[model samples]
Target: MAEALADIGMIGLAVMGSNLAQNIERNGFTVAVWNRDPGRVDEFMATVGAGKKFVGAHTPEAFVNAIARPRKIMLLVKAGDATDWTIDQIKPYLEPGDIIIDGGNALYHDTIRREKALRAEGFNFIGCGVSGGEEGALWGPSLMPGGAPDAYENLRPIWEAIAAKVDDGPCVTYIGPDGAGHFVKMVHNGIEYGDMQLIAEAYDLLKRVGHLTAPELAAVFAAWNEGVLQSFLIEITSQIFRAIDPETNQPLVELILDKAGQKGTGKWTSEAALDMGVPVPTIQAAIDARVLSSMKDERVAASQVIVGPPTSPEMPDKGDFIMLVHNALYASKICSYAQGMAMLSTASRAYNWNLNLGEISRIWKGGCIIRAQFLDKIKQAYHRRADLPNLLLDPDFNQWMADAQTSWRSVVSIGALAGVPLPAMSASLAYFDSYRTARLPQNLTQAQRDFFGSHTYERIDKPEAGFVHTEWKELIQ
Candidate 1:
């Protein structure tokens, strides 16, 4: 009989799983590796796992048996049916206190249901959201683990050792219970969509209206990376603009197809927001932008038929126009984060998650895809007031928006005049405007609903009156 020497067992030897396994082993813990296919295990052991603290296991029984007591097994396998199947395979061999972690992009509701099912069997299941792509996994990714507090405590050392470090603190945190981790990750993706779309709009306006070339645009983005807009996305955008096609000797971005692909997280964020009655219009617009991008064929056909606007618009002052676009991008980015933060705050209350918004923002300051310098400001904002309704209300963000409003409106107007669609940017501007306004035309909408469906409306003038229905047609007559 062999002794249980491995600290952790990792199933699924795919890119993310393999990298994460190496990361765990690199932090001085012995890791046991397995795969759905035995060949992958052999291959990993022969290649990357070679000369490392890794135990390659061939059977599910061997994998579970090799791990120490109160066994910790992480599944980096596909979400949905695959995750459930993997759990079932090893469930019989696990002890009561054993922990199972699913580190994949899963729906939060599914995570909640899985936790309930596993709890019934005396096991702890964690839905952990890992972010930062392939490189981050190999190095240090931001980790979001949602489960029992004791389960998190069991995995704390390994997670803290492997997560990205910023200002001497790790980017991993206990993100409440049940599905909070995955829900927060979904919101992160939604904000990422908004970020990318805003950057794309800024690129378009600079190219079409300001007449900047690829290298010139790259220089501009590089400059932005040095200032308040410094972010992973902005830095990468600069790199993307500078990349050249080796085959054609042209700018790579120009040669690439316009269509954008999504993996459903952004849509999930929007759907969840709609269901919760939270206004995530900027996130919704980002998803809609992707949907519109997919209709490239229709767009090309429409380009042929549409004859109203000229492609060549009068160019604006280069320096001043660049600043305008910068301010517009910054202002819109604030609105998108405001909406995402609001969603998180609402979810925390609705689900009884007790999520620490400041801690969440702090964890996002490092390895996540949406990592930004502005996140520190958000962390500070929430730290000052945990129950703050929205990021837009923060004094710093409020003043920034106030100063940028004219520039933001001008950029949107320019996009409309130039026949360039600014879906995310314009939607963010609208979100900001609508949020700040005291009175809206929705009263008319309420009256129309009451007249048609007798849904009823509330009276503003009468203090005691509530939920009243009106005979609008008879009153008009």
Candidate 2:
């Protein structure tokens, strides 16, 4: 018997890994697979890999040996310790110039550390971000690969072949060195958090204030999906509202628990932004909303104890409210993207990643969780002005904001008066307003900081070079 060779080897025969392997095989490449558990390898070989051109290996060494020279092995294991352990297990079998691609939702710093350690040992480590869940793994997902140019060059053909296409171009690109790909993916998840929260807020307003039934809300979301709001999240949200519970014969959404869960990427984004001194209020607010939602018992108790205005605000005209909610959602979404992009810009500069924001937007236009018609406009914005400091400042987005401001404000105000929680929406509006303001109340904040902690404050009349401290209680001292 001859040793079977594979173009690429993938470890961790989980759903994502198996599907991605199948996708690679379907695209005219032979894939070798291995899993931590032998049963999984045998199961996959018996099932999804049964008819595919696959080489199933029971051990890491076998997986490495089955691949062709300068092996391409991708790890789709759990992030953190598992990723490190897998690398340790496979390192002995890998030779110089071989590539190891991590396709998990890892912290960016972890990717950076691993890349540096591997590259020093003559191996290429690529932290690749794969988006669009199981279906995407089997078909086409947006791929973001970050590593040395040589490694990317070697993997480019396979990546481009298996990636989603938009406007006849693959949704895969070299994001930059080290962890740039995973960093972008983390921000993508953060923005996804903001988007979902904003949509949920809109739904709450429509249901609580406008008194719409679940089916009616579904219709509204479905209609919005045809316009600028067209995106994966919105499309699924509409479907979610329309789903009926098999047991209760009521809308499944209503029957579900109110608690929301997270897997850390959103929290990582917020933490990274804070550490970098970048403001991502919309993302932060979305995370906060989830934290608040998780306190379902506390919220229920508080609702009974903490009373608001005796009556809820009267519902506005349905036609007008619908348009207002639409504008509000669109405007807030723009702000959320702006915040995320701003964070990316800051990160790029700080880390010397040289990330191409325009290319990032282009790749995000399809086969990602955040894919949308609006991303086309975003791509255009970045293309028109490669150095676009913020999406809110883009000419088209600026004009859209101007047109939407009145309705956007009305929706927020109405939600407030009706006691409907609109954390993400309100935070986005606040971020937009703060960005546009030439003079913020931050001066007072600075002064208070200086007064309490002797922190220095910069004067508006002086150049940015100097930081001065003021004395507030000389006599008391």
Candidate 3:
């Protein structure tokens, strides 16, 4: 094994894997190669790694045997159950203290479970969330790693040497404890859902109300990048809008559908929040929006799909309505992040994971899909106080929301008047206002409790609880 890979490192190359391997090799790391398909490695070396020396392994055992001493193998595969099977396949041959990183979206619990199982086998496991698209992989990524702190230290050279730089530099850190890394990535994806929904809502308003072309919308997004909205999400939205439809010469966006896809992370985040009793309204609604979108044909068949209002059905108010939508989107986005991070904070406390919210936000600043200007605020929000309940309540963020509420309200009302569902977006702002209101609709709430949990209710202005003069509660009293 030493002779086979002593000089450098090894990579398992797929399209992304190949680019990433070349990235590692380009940085002067020796990269041994393997794949489910042996042919792909040869092709990758020929094209991406041109003239690079690479070792190929025929089997998982042989692959483990081929790495150099104090053995280390980084597993880059599809996330979840598949990741576990890959680790299990390689475990028998890995020696004590050998490091294996699961660089995919395995559940944090799974990471913790895997860490325990492998450590008991005298091997160390690191669950790493490697972000940045292929580009980030080749250049550098925002790496969130969790496991034994010593194991992270052992792998720091590789992570730091291959990560993006912040003012603080190098977007890599030990996210603490067994599952913190995956947990951060989970929140990362949850916020991502809200961010995408915000963008889509923006596009929907601009297109529907302003009658803006894709190119026009793209230009607007590009300008946003120069302002408070400046971030990766806006940058890409600008580019995506500019793409021309070759046949029609119109913006390519018109050719696209109003549907989006997810690979379970968003749903998982919402589900986890519900289980923990966290009020993650924005993130949960984001998931619901996608589920509703996916039921397109069935919805149409059932006459359940409806687009309520025209862009400006009332007195040429389209522009005002559009601005309001933007405000609503922004505020709701804050709610989503707050909810997701709150969940992380809760899990961290209950599970004893001293997760760093500041570090997590900083990584999302650059690489990976969900990168947005809002993340910078989030980083600042947490940096100022690690224990902040949520980003919206962060002092500066609250100021921003206070300034933006009128616009948000206008947008929600316009959407309502115009007859757009605006359910997720409007509901997001509703969650925000509700959180801050110190009061809510509990008129039916007490009835709901009495109906099921049999809890007593209170008078409208009284602190004292009184059971309703209903059959069950009155008899029990």
After superposition, candidate 2 runs with Cα above 4 Å error: 1-4, 462-465, 474-477
lDDT of 2 by residue, 317-396 (tens): 99789989999999999999999999989999999999899899989988899999999898889899988899998999
Global local distance difference test of model 3: 0.75
The ten-residue window of minimal lDDT in model 3 covers: 1-10
Tell me the tens digit of each residue's lDDT in model 1 across 379-407. 99998888999988889899999999999
Candidate 1 global lDDT: 0.93
Error of 3 at 250 (Å): 2.6
**What is the per-residue lDDT of model 3 for residues 262-283, given as tens digits with 9 covering 90 to 100?**
8888987877788778887777
Report the Cα lDDT for residue 293, model 2: 94
lDDT of 1 at 40: 98
Question: Against the true structure, what is every candidate's RMSD?
Answer: 1.2, 1.7, 3.2
Evaluated at residue 283, the lDDT of candidate 3 is 77
Q: After aligning candidate 2 to the native by TM-score, how far in Å is the CA of 359 from where it should be?
A: 0.7
Candidate 2 backbone collisions, by pair: none
Structural similarity to truth (TM-score) of each candidate: 0.98, 0.97, 0.90
Indicate which candidate wins on TM-score: 1
